[model samples]
Target: MKAVVYEGPNVLTYKDVADVSPKANEVKLKVRACGICGSDVHGYLGITGRRIPPVIMGHEFSGEIVELGEGVNNLKPGDRVAAYPLDFCGSCEMCAKGDVHLCLNKRAFGVLDVDGAFAEYICVPAKVCFKLKDSVSYKVGSIMEPLAVSYRAVSHAGNLTGKNVLVVGTGTIGLLALSCVKAQNPRRIFVSDLSDSRLEIAKKMGADTVINPSKENSLDVIMDNTNNKGVDAVIEAVGVSATVKQSIDSLAFGGTAVWIGISDKHIDLEMQKIVTRELNVKGTFLYGFEEFRTVVEMLNEGKLNIDPILSKEITLEELPETMAQMAAGAGDIIKVTVVNND
Candidate 1:
């Protein structure tokens, strides 16, 4: 088996490695397609401490089951599947409350304490694998993880029917969030980003208005669009102090704001404004099992079109250079998937 092993900062080696086998409760999958997430680029650049070196870093993927473990009966070899990527203890309080993503003992693939799908073959817990419908391609299946993230973020805003919504950042997650928000039939959707290329894609993805903060004021656009009342909901996907502030500043009184991006920078907020406006601020992490399943179903049903969001597909051998480009801020590309052609 060949794997792209992360050696250190900005170093990825494509070399032969030992083939993986399934544990008693696990199943081995032959990799098909795996998408490079923003977190992967950050990890490759040693910016995020979540991904340690010597690990195969990829969690958004789809594969075919080649070997089933001893006790696995629900699925068999030759089944196409996508995995949830998070291994959580079902007995935890969070899990009991259906918040498995926040379980006390949760481990995610391609991140902490687990090897992931940046290889020809990888093994995952059988319980985490979901059978992919024949209609869904491996490339689309691999993107379900990110789609689920966007779904969870929009879900945090409650019902969006006939409400104005603004999405900060037109990155992969932000663009996907825009699509998900559109599905709820919002009155209008606005997307903000620094990249004009991404903003163009956001327009095609159903953003009623797109703003480039580098040139024009995003708050001014939001204000003018809403007649100075601000949007009813804002999705902050950039995970930066400035974007977070903008999200807060662009919300209407009694509106909701969903923060999906992860960042370490400290942000100052106007507590007085929050209290006076009675605004609802929520932080959304990864999706739960239900949201993940819903996204898979949505893909299967063709309710979510991912064609425009998929920017490029490359072979495993090109992973290193691709990661480098992404680390350097590949603004033109939205999503890059590594296809295992071997």
Candidate 2:
């Protein structure tokens, strides 16, 4: 099997590697499409210590099952599927309570040491595979992971009906979260980003207003647009001190703010503002198993529009260089997905 292996920091090589087979209760999949995430870029640059050398780094993916290990009966060969990517111990207390993402023993693909779907073929637990409809393209199926992340963030925001909402970033997750908020029929949706191109895309994806924080103060713009009352809810998709502060400051009294970005490990918070305003602050990581399944259904049922989400499609051989370009600051690229033509 040929894979783009991460040999070291800022280095990836396309070479032949040993083939992988399905373990018991697992399924071997011929990967069709895999989306490059921001985390992968960070790992490539050696900024994040998660992606160590010699590991394949791709998690958002969809494929066709080529072989099933023993004890697997719910699916068969040739079935198209998208995976949850988080291999969790199903008998844990967190798993029993439907919080698989919080499972005590969990290994997320493409993070830390677990090898992901950046190769021709990979194997995953049969339980994490979700069958995809014929109508859903492999490209769309590949993005279910991030979509699930956005969906979970929106779910944390509670109800958005007729309420003014603000999304503090126009990145892929922010845009997807804006779309999820739109589905609830919010009174208005404001998106903030430094890039005008991403802001334009956000507008088409149902944002009522776009704010370039570099040009104008986002808090002032959000406040002025909402008639000085501030937004009812905010989804902070940029995990930085400034944006996290902006999200907290741009919310109305009793408003909810959900933080999903992991750009920074630690940042100072406005403790007085949150405490005085009685604001609800929640930090969300990855999506639970059910959220991943629901995102697939949302795309399958045509309730979610992911067509505007993907920015580029490349072959597996092109992933390394593409990732390098992305690290060098390609603001126009939102989501780059790798496809297997073979």
Tens-digit lDDT string for candidate 2 (29-84): 99999999988998999887999888998999999999999999999999999999
RMSD of each: 2.0, 1.9
TM-score of candidate 1 against the unseen true structure:
0.92
Q: Estimate each model's TM-score.
A: 0.92, 0.93
Model 1: lDDT of residue 228: 94
Encode model 1's per-residue lDDT on 24-132: one tens digit a residue.
9899999999999888988888876888878999999999999988999999999999999888889999999999889899889999547889999999999989889
Question: Following a full C-alpha superposition, what root-mean-square deviation does model 1 have from the true structure?
Answer: 2.0
Q: After superposition, how far is residue 16 of candidate 2 from its true place, in Å?
A: 1.3
